[model samples]
Target: MTVICEECGKVYHVDPDKLDRYKGKNVRVRCGECGHVTQMSRLMDAAEEPAYDFEKAAAPSMPSAAPPQREMPEEPAPRPDIAYRTAGTEGRAGWLGLRGKMVILFLVIPILLLAISGYLSQQLLRQMATDITDESTELVLQEGKEKLMQKARDVAKQCEVYLQNHPTLEREDFFYDPEFSMLAVQVVGESGYTCLIQQPEPERGQNWTIWAHPNPNIIGIDDIDMIRKALGPHFEDFFKVLGASEGMRESDGNYMWKDPDGKIREKYMAVAPINLEGLPFLLMSTAYIDEFTAKTEYLKEYANNKTAEIRNINVGVLLIVIIIIGLCILIYGYRLTRSIQYLTEAADRISVGDLEAEIDIKSKDEIGNLADAISRMQDSLRFSIERLRRRR
Candidate 1:
């Protein structure tokens, strides 16, 4: 017979045949684990009807008991249906009931945040790179423009030195003298050249003469209106500097032209008044803006490539980080759930009144504290049982 304690729900298996002294009477059995006493009736396994009818078998006049014969029932007796169940376990919700909720809150949410943060960082990188390049390009363009102006100043200084060496040279010598003429035709750089043009003398009915220039066809031409037209729409700016006092210089507005390749491009020019010993000369310097910006196109291309590469690398790294994070979450969640499983088993044991069962978990977390509480309860119950037995 299986007995379950009503006080602590402890289960005990006792053989009914061994309870010979308490046959058919109520007896108390103390549970070994919690010491709970339960009343149970001892039972003897006796058949309901005899296998043979004894009254019919015994005959008063039989000289000798003829060989005894036994009568059997037509059918076997029905077996009793007995089932054993632990007390207080019907309320258990089962394992894995709470782990699913924990997984969503602790694992899923953080992974989404990680991916979002990574994408945002990747997006901002391109803008950051653009800002850096823009700042550096501004400085380079300013330096290039400054260098052009300095070149103009150096040319003016060279002409001053040339005039000092030729003390007796007259004003007209600048046009025909080979040495002075070559100085004006020197190329500053590609798309840049030096030139000397004289001011218009309206009194003598003489027009502006290009005294020295890279273009031999225009050297002695007195075509004033035609020359201004060839200087393009922004020629007034050059005229402003030319008419200024000696040593004065100024920049003209940007000049637009189509090169031999037919691509529209821009350049800028500056003019300074040159008085070499009273010989009036206009020193004009011209250079294309394309020279300064030529490398900028390539730099812009490289920046684009760099941005693409960085984004790709960022995505790859994000994927790797996510994988690593997911693995860690799984490992930690498993361990946490395992601890919970221990608490569950210990609780089941206590519910069945098995107070002596060891809760071997030694952790200091919540589950361990719960086991300690159960141990305390077991001790209290055991002590109460001892006191009651002593009083009895």
Candidate 2:
């Protein structure tokens, strides 16, 4: 026969033959687990009815040999249902519980999102700063190129007018005349100048030559090899722009040039034709592009530094925010779950007939309302239990 303790739900197995002695009498057995008394006479009547052939076979052949006493077995194994309930309770003892899940949901997940957002924001700031710097540099370079070209055209026109006024001025005596040399050659920017150079005419056996220049040694040069030796690998790019001045049209480009100290630097060149009947000379204005873009470079560097500084500040602020959020969740969740734990323990006590369990929650939140309701229910249960006891 199987008997269960009502208060604690601990199951016990009773020998059917031992129960036959108290079959029709008011006998009771005390549960060893909880000491709750269970009347065996009611179970004995049910045990007498055979619901299956197996029970009838297991029963004692003679009822006169039954024991005179009814008692619980010394050791009883819990049923499968009891074991399953215990295992279920143990499963919730780890991080799968409510508090662990709340940390993951409100703290861990939010911090991950904040980190991702901060990374993307920093990347966007860097890209925007780079784009602005590139655009500003381009605008400054374009304006510089236009201004340099205009200066070359104006100087070329002035030289043509001066040469036409002096019709008898010979090519060999051009640089010797101070007034004509000053009109033909002039300074451009820092380490830059305008000079007169005629295009190569193989039909006349005259190579590309510089007629008037600031440097006296460079003037009247028709040797291509000497020019190539001076310019190095950048000779082709320089002449390419200079050659584009054919048909009396204007042309301009950039090329790397070797300075007197053998250092290489990027220089811009603008060519404008000097239309003096027989002279087919061109005025070339050349200057280092860095001269006009220095302020732009500085601004770009400033913008990049500012962007990095702002990104660092944002990262610090993000870390602070994550820390603050984590602290709030920890403190708030601890208090919230602590209150819940108290209510749960009180409910457990009430379920076990310990109506004296106190709910000390004082907050006027939903938890407080729930505590009040449970307190009322506990009072009603105590009152009903008291009334039943009085009647008994």
Candidate 3:
């Protein structure tokens, strides 16, 4: 397309694509030939012209017949190389830029850190509970063992008195006394008793006999075989108590046994000697380790509740901190991005020959400095352009 500049009257070729922007309107542009400013108007001719195929018009209706001449397609109009571009406009809204991406990362990092912190805190709380559980169990076991030893000694003294009061009674008859049998049966824990065992009677060709037992069903039964089978790992410990009671007034020993509740735990046996003239019997008490710390379940429940509370509070606080930090970063980033948007639009207008476009923002940052520099550059460009026109 050819257009004559109104100012310079210089005829120049202008691609129709550039004039497409001025459809039904006038736009001013500097003439490439003489720097003369000219106003050009173009109408897009929107009257909806019907498209015609030139090949069809020239081909004629020929079926399976060779055509004499080939028609060539018309050449397309050349597009303009000069396009009006606003600086930063093409990339502003659709995708995240470097500045926006950095801001997003800054906000997200804190949330991840807080999540890790919350997990670590919960583990610490559970570990502390386990420690407290172990420590309290040990303390109660020690105290219970001491009390059990003292109780055995008291029962030994009562046995000595019972022997002395029944002076005429045979040792065998006294051990099976109905009053003593009732006392032994009433006692609990570890399924044991403070009773007598007699060595083998050579006169009857019999092995050692259980003179008495807390369980009446085992009374007058053979002691050795039954004791070993019933006691399991405790069989040796029982014999140790039987032999050691002759010398030591009191002693303590350990064995493994299942409790009435069906849990296997350590059982401590306390043995004390009853000093009877000719017949010696050992007074014994067996107590399970768990019996000492009966409050363990309560303690554990309380600890769990308290740990849950602390974990809840810790999580709540961490979430609050993360939210506050994220909000602050988001708000700060939004303000910074808004200021940059203003500078971008101003720069965009300047790039398209709108030198009078005001940056309009006053700030004490690098962005503000850049705005001042661009304004100066605009003035410089206008001055240089005017000087060139005057020289021309």
lDDT (10s digit) by residue, model 2, range 1-392? 66665455455666656545443443456667666555544345444432234434533475767664343344554321211112334333565666677779987898889889888988998899889888999999999999899989999999889888988988777788899889878887777788888877768777678888888986777746776788988899887887788766799999888888998889999999998776768888999999988989998899989988998898898889878978887888888888877787787556645577678999799989999999999999889867864553
Give per-residue lDDT, candidate 1, residue 237. 52
Name the regions of candidate 3 deviating beyond 4 angstroms. Answer: 1-18, 21-80, 86-105, 161-166, 175-214, 230-251, 258-266, 358-373, 376-380, 383-392
- lDDT of candidate 2 at residue 240, scale 0 to 100: 84
List of clashing residue pairs for candidate 3: none
Q: lDDT by residue for model 3 over 1-392, one digit each (tens)?
A: 44444445444455656665553464445656555554445653433222234235423477666655553343443332333454565855657764567556875675777778778878888888978976887787787777777777777677667767867756556546886554433354444445544544567675555555665666667767766766677678666755555454577877776444755576777877667755545667776665666677568778889999988898888778877877777787777788887788777666656666677768778878887888898899779867865664
Model 3 scores a TM of 0.66
RMSD of each: 12.2, 10.8, 13.3
Evaluate residue 90 in candidate 3 and report its C-alpha lDDT on the 0 to 100 scale. Answer: 84
**lDDT of all predictions:** 0.63, 0.76, 0.64
Please give the distance, in angstroms, between residue 311's alpha carbon in candidate 3 and its true position after superposition.
Answer: 2.6
Residue-level lDDT of model 1, residues 158-207, one tens digit each, is 77677788877665566577888776566766778877766666676665
